[model samples]
Target: MVTINLTLNNFSELPSLLDVFGCFGNDYEYTTRGLLRRKIPPVCFICSTLMVHNGYNPHTKEGPGEINIGR
Candidate 1:
């Protein structure tokens, strides 16, 4: 498994990251305490962070967007 330390300063980059990781599956989204949350797939998270997966697909390219975690 791979881990990424992301500092999201803005919301714009959320969608882009979600798309790139193919995390749009039905079970990917959920609501917790009235706040919407997304579940990052272990494979997607690993592949995206490490930039290497045994079964990596060439079509899915790394996202060029930036996430701002600032409040």
Candidate 2:
């Protein structure tokens, strides 16, 4: 068996990482040093962090084009 390791280079890479797991199905596993032993939220950390990075604030809905992503 061969094993591969992945290091998250940036928050922007989150979407690509998600695509990898979605395509891999049961072949992938989330193996952090000691994180897998505990119970994490069902929402998943990557998606939540990405949403915040994209300025998706639940409390503020200023307008349709209000988000300043600054890209």
Winning candidate number (lDDT): 1
lDDT digits (tens) for residues 1-71 of candidate 1: 21222455535566665555454445434332333333543344545543222334444456756699989
Number of the top-ranking candidate, with TM-score as the measure: 2
What would the per-residue lDDT of candidate 2 be over residues 10-64, giving only the tens digit for each residue?
Answer: 4566667566545543433455552221122233243442233223444323343
lDDT of each: 0.44, 0.42
Cα lDDT, model 2, residue 18: 63
User: For each candidate, what TM-score against the reference?
Assistant: 0.20, 0.24
List, in order, the clash count of every candidate structure. Answer: 6, 0
For candidate 1, what is the lDDT?
Answer: 0.44
In model 1, how large is the Cα lDDT of residue 13? 69
Model 1: weakest 10-residue lDDT segment is 50-59
